[model samples]
Target: MTERIVVVAAALYDGDRLLAARRSAPPELAGRWELPGGKVERGETPEQALSRELLEELGVAAEVVERVPGEWPLKPPYVLQAWRARLLPDSPDPKPLQDHDELRWLTPDELWDVNWLDQDVEAVREAAFRGAGNCATSPNAPAPAPRQNPPNS
Candidate 1:
């Protein structure tokens, strides 16, 4: 069986607002919004990979707080894992330095305003449900866990 590749995404937030990035490349995905992040390199932990990706793609430093509750399938052999993140106090504001062409900060109510990439829609919903103040989690649901490498890695 082919080994699965993990792509990490950040549901980066400030107060109650989440950051959304608009893709600018790979014509097919251009103009679609997504939670900014990238693939995990073999030797790095997901948290490390996420931080590096944020710096590379958004030009800001971020702290990956916890893993979002669920995973989504990408193209064959690639699966998406999202984490809740926050900008570091000393970091500069995010800019679309790479894969993205635009950035927007959306409050919980504005979350659906952007045209999110198809594969990212559910993950974004799950992230907001768990992290955004306006979206409540059920008492029976487990809290998001801190970053950890997936089992059997």
Candidate 2:
């Protein structure tokens, strides 16, 4: 059996708003919006990979607060996992540095306004459900402490 690979996605929030990134490459996925993140490289924890990816793809420093409760299947041998993340105080604003062409911050009520990638739909829903419950209304809200143990892939 082929081993499964984990793709960590960030349900990155600023206040009650979640960050969505629009793919700019890979013809099939281009133009669809999804959470910004990437694959976990061998030897790296999902949290570490997520932080690295957010910095690379969105040009910001983010802290992974907690894991979303469930996982969803992606293409064969790959699965998607989500974590709630927030920007660090000293980090720069997010930019479409790579793999994306546009970025938007959507409040809970506007989550579905953009066309989401099919594979990401359920994960976003799960993240939104969990995130909305935990999110604070003010952008200045303190971020939850990062979890000590990341969920197993």
Number of the predicted model whose TM-score against the real structure is largest? 1
Q: Estimate each model's TM-score.
A: 0.87, 0.86
Q: What TM-score would you give candidate 2 relative to the actual structure?
A: 0.86
Question: Each model's C-alpha lDDT?
Answer: 0.86, 0.84
Residue pairs that clash (backbone atoms under 3 angstroms), model 2: none
Best by lDDT: 1
lDDT of 1 by residue, 1-153 (tens): 999999999999999899999888888887888999999999999999999999999989998899998889999899999999999999999999998888999887777667788888878878888876665434255433422321111
- Backbone clashes in model 1, listed as residue pairs: none
